[model samples]
Target: MKPNVLLIMVDQMRADCLSILDHPVVDTPNLDQLARDGVLFENAYSATPSCVPARASVLTGMSQASTGRVGYQDKVPWNYEHTLAGEFTNADYHTQAIGKMHVYPTRNLTGFHNVVLHDGYMHYSRFKHNTKTIESQEYTDDYLNWLRGKTGQADLIDLGLDCNSSTVTRPWHLAEELHPTNWVTTESIDFLRRRDPTKPFFLNMSYVRPHPPFDPPQVFYDMYKDLELPDPSFGGWAETEDTSGEGMSPVTAKGLVPKMRLKRAQAAYYALITHIDHQIGRFLNAMQEFGVYHNTVILFASDHGELLGDHNLFRKSLPYEGSAKVPFILADPGNNLGLKENSRVDKAVEMRDIMPTLLDAADIGIPDTVDGKSVMPLCKDGEDMPWREYIHGEHAFGEKSFHYITDGKEKYIWFSQNGEEQFFDLENDPQEMTNLLKVVDYQERIEKRRNQLVKELEGREEGYSDGKSLIAGRTPKPTLRFVFE
Candidate 1:
């Protein structure tokens, strides 16, 4: 029988938050145990570093360039022919997505047999003008409808917190069992109980938390309310000024927040992560009770990382480690594929790799459209297997638009709006506190990485490169024309 696959995904969680990774403040005992049972990938990234495009890569098993979703534009149709769930469905698996599809039309199944979606306060979908259409959460979000049925509330944001704001935070107002995080687990457990027992399953249990509004359940919030949390890392290259009042805005993307306010946000953010972690534990226990825990292939990851005041940045879409890196843990508890247990791999992987990896675990054939390689070999003793030299990441963030190349030990970033550049020796400067572009010892290394970026962009329609040098001042678009074609 084919092994069941469980892909547990979270939103806006930092790469370093796992307690196993020595995160001083946050504790994720369940995830730490999950890592011990399988493999922990230390250098995983979201190439696009935003929700829409990053999730596109996860679902389609394609790079950002191939998906033509290099930024955070919503409402574009997910026109891909092959998806992770579609492939599993082709193999006769009972595929279900329980939470947070984040796709356009909101309910577009994207190949899942069914989707229980709650995209978590999408501004475009929740716009008063769009509420009459399918774009509204009222029409598409199962969790929202369910919440209303349970609490007589019209919306999840009844507490008046902006979904995207990092500065505002409070404990969850509803009953703990009614929270979105718990609802995702509760629904997932219910699926396991009622699912087709004759066929293997492919379940994507996604959560939207640790993202914003900074609200975890009240118990979780109090757990870290007074604990000393690590201060956000500040790079010398980051602007420290509060000019233009952007610093005081609740949803400011890049600005200096008052230290106390930032700390409260961090506390709430960590609380959400731990809450999700416990919910994951709850789901795993249910899997064990159902007698499928040992036979399952589990993969856990996040769409992207939140900056959370790192370098004075509050949200994602930047190429910094705090914004792009994500936690990736894959556990094959049954040893079905001969994977090494409790291992850590330093290979630089990304969201696109996930689909292929899970497919490989289930002995399914990968589709031709996939650009990512299966990490199964790396999980075993196949060190001799050829691997990617680096990962190329980019985002279209207007004035802050950037393309980056990193091999985990070093990173090179180039701003498209201007000819500005930043380089970091990631091994020595893990916090990215100093830019090393002008360092005499690293000029040659920086040049080689720059050429790699040029090669990657050679034939793109954006005219970002000339096959020899990167060109500046080109307008960066959220998607390429091919997506429409």
Candidate 2:
């Protein structure tokens, strides 16, 4: 029988939060053990760092450009013919997804054998006047329906927390078992029990937490409330005197917040992560009890990272490491693929690589539709294996819309609305405290990176480049025109 595959994913989890990676405050013993037993990729990034577009790349094995989802947008139909789950089903694997499949037309399934979904709080789906009746959570989300059935409450908002708020912090108001994170683990373990024994299974266990609401169960919240957490890092370029009172808003993307509130939010966010870690431990133990522990191929990653007040920015979709980078671990505990154990790779990989990697591990054929190459070679052959030099990332954030290219050691940024440029030597300053754009010594290197960006955007509908240089003032769209084609 082919090896079973398990893809563990979390929403808005920072790449640097693992204790193995020396994250100062957060304790994730389960994740740390997962890393120890797997090959960890230190430079994995989301090419388009947001919930919707990032998930598109993960599901389809397509680059952001190929997916035509270069930015965050909701309500767009997921019209792809191939998906990670669909491909597994094609090979006769029993594929089931539990928790957070943020696709549109919420029940689309995207080719899963079955999906137990909880996309968390989406404004578009919850609106009273939503034109598409099928889009509402009441009509689709399995977790919400379960919560409503278990408790009399209609929604998570009963706790008085906004899903996307950055400044708000609170403990979950319900029983610990009812939290969405625990529900995902519980449903996943249940699937293991109920799965078909004759066929290899593909299980996607996705958790929606550490994203916002900043609410963890009370025990988790107490874990880091008074631990003297690290303050948020601010870049010199991002500091401002305006203090326009915008930061006071609960969900403002860019603004200075009170130090106490920010620390509390960080504590809550860490609490949620630790809570997820514990839940992951629970599921892993269940896997052992069910006798699938030895013959499984497990890959762990996140859709994207939260800025968590880095550079005074909250949420995702920015080119900064805190928002775009994510933790990636591929563990073949059975040595099914002869992979190097307890290793680390610094290659610049992205979410798009996931489908091909998992498919390759299962000895399944990678379809021609996949833009991402299987990263299995990197694990087997180490740095001697050939790989892409850098990854290009972009997001459509109005005036803040930007394009970036990085090779893990350095990054180059170009604003599409204006011709402004910024560069950071990530090797020397991982926090991106200083911009090196105007530095006399780094001018030649900066020019080379700029030319690379110009080459990357050479031919496109957006008219962002004219071959020789980047064109300014071009409007960026969340979805490229080819999406409709």
Q: Give the CA lDDT, 0 to 100, for residue 38 in model 1.
A: 92
Model 2: worst 10 consecutive residues (lDDT sum): 239-248
Model 2 spans > 4 angstroms off = none
lDDT, residue 474, model 2? 90
Backbone clashes counted, model 2:
0
Model-by-model lDDT, in order?
A: 0.92, 0.91
The clash count for each model shown is 0, 0
> Residue pairs in steric clash, candidate 2?
none
| Decoy 1 TM-score against native | 0.99
Top candidate (lDDT): 1
TM-score of 2: 0.98
**lDDT for predicted candidate 1 compared with the true structure:** 0.92
List candidate 1 stretches off by more than 4 Å.
none
